[model samples]
Target: MNHTTFETPVVSRARTVERLVAGQPTSDGAGVKLTRVLTNTLQRRLDPFLMLDAFGSDNPGDYIAGFPDHPHRGFETITYMIAGRMRHRDSAGHEGLLSNGGVQWMTAGRGVIHSELPEQEEGRMEGFQLWLNLPAKDKMRDPWYRDIPSGEIPEFTRDGVQVRVIAGASHGVPGAVQRDQTEPLYLDLHLEPGARFEQTLDPALNAFVYVYRGGLSIGDTAVPVQRMALLANGGDTQGIVLQAGEQPTRALLIAGRPLNEPIAQYGPFVMNTRDQLMQAVEDFQNGKLA
Candidate 1:
């Protein structure tokens, strides 16, 4: 609910881009076209963070079918809708409409069956769905869900840059939600032409930035549109600095405390070991996953 304005933070040693990756073209949710920015391959390196999928399309045919009833366990899903509308229904009896600039945060603690279907027949459906892993002790916790309207999220503007704190604190501004296990930091940055922004981050957290509109620079690395730059981690860097070029740019900056725990994933289910995964599958098959 914070529409406050503030000055940008100072970063003494900004983290540079370790790898520049182009999102892979893929489809999910009953044929919804999207770009998989964070794939399964990087799960280990990212830890607590599992996947980040970006989807945007003007053609209704591309996203109309939406995501059918799907089972998820041992993790959380944060769907940020940039445009259009989608209805969500889950086994836990939670339902909501995610419209433009809204977020649907759901935790499939032990397990849950859900569906995300488009509420529109035409126009654009643009958004990002991020999957975050749970800690071993809390993997089987009860399911939880929350719908966050755009205005409810805490945000601040500094100069020409606007920072939306989705999950963690930014420049003394707390986000809409917080998690103790991962201490995740999710920010949506909107920068005007020639604007510069800076954020302070814990050196121990793993971090990355995905440029969705226009392009920007991180140190010497040029992050173009549709590209994700994995930030280098270490005690050497204090945070990150972002500067927009001639044109306005928008991006998602995400970081999180590493779980450093073993990750066992089998499709929709993510657990601690192979045996646990098998048990999850069995639970789903037996209609007990929810």
Candidate 2:
């Protein structure tokens, strides 16, 4: 892992916690138990970010079947593996094994068929899959994929807090992945007891924090494990202040610039209009989606 110090930004008006959300328990992709944190309903509220699913389980039955072949279009999928092993195969001829602390980023531009299956029989499988939408102009471009290993990610430590820059810039360090359409910022933070951290934000971006382990607080709101705090935007809110409680904590802070464009989605296909979505469905059913 690489380490670098950074000059902390000043937070004149720290953003407050808009609301705390408990993840809805759900099973997906052949009965893989997981929590659907960011659902379809919040798509407009969290524009450019379509969905966020957090999956973790120790039982082989929970994730063994994995995700069979599927099709996706008009978006990108960022799968961050926190533990266990999984293999990815796609119609774009992309293949990779995702282990602990790795990230698999795939752009289903135009469209692509893919499958993700666990390589482990037991142990623990934990990770998150975040769907990021693309602009209309780039939606039908060539497909792309990348498997970022654990060692390739960048991180920094300060005052008992560890920050992983997954996407966008953090402090003075740029993340492993960047996008101009959304300008998404994704960070995994691990904090020791009583630790505090801060980060600056643009007022135009929408953001949220998901606590996966231990507990933390944002502006008097107690965000327990498995909860997400939707950060308030606009006005004088320019940054965020996070304080861990008596126990160590781990969380993902995600923010992104809104596209402010029309959104039409059907199952896995997301497009800018209803006609486009229908076209995607026809393409998939007519054996031409990939």
Q: Pick the candidate with the highest lDDT.
A: 2
User: In candidate 1, which residue pairs clash?
Assistant: none
lDDT of 2 at 51: 94
Model 1 C-alpha lDDT per residue in residues 127-220, reported as the tens digit of each score: 9999999999989999999999998989888789888889988988989989997999999999998898889998899999999999999999
Worst 10 residues of 2 by lDDT: 1-10
* Per-residue lDDT over 15-107 for candidate 2, one digit per residue giving the tens place of the 0 to 100 score: 998888888999988999999999988999889899999999888999999999999999999999999999999998999999999999999
Residue pairs clashing in model 2 are none
What total of clashing residue pairs does each candidate reach?
0, 0
In angstroms, the error of model 1 at 178 is 0.4
Give the alpha-carbon lDDT of every model.
Answer: 0.92, 0.93
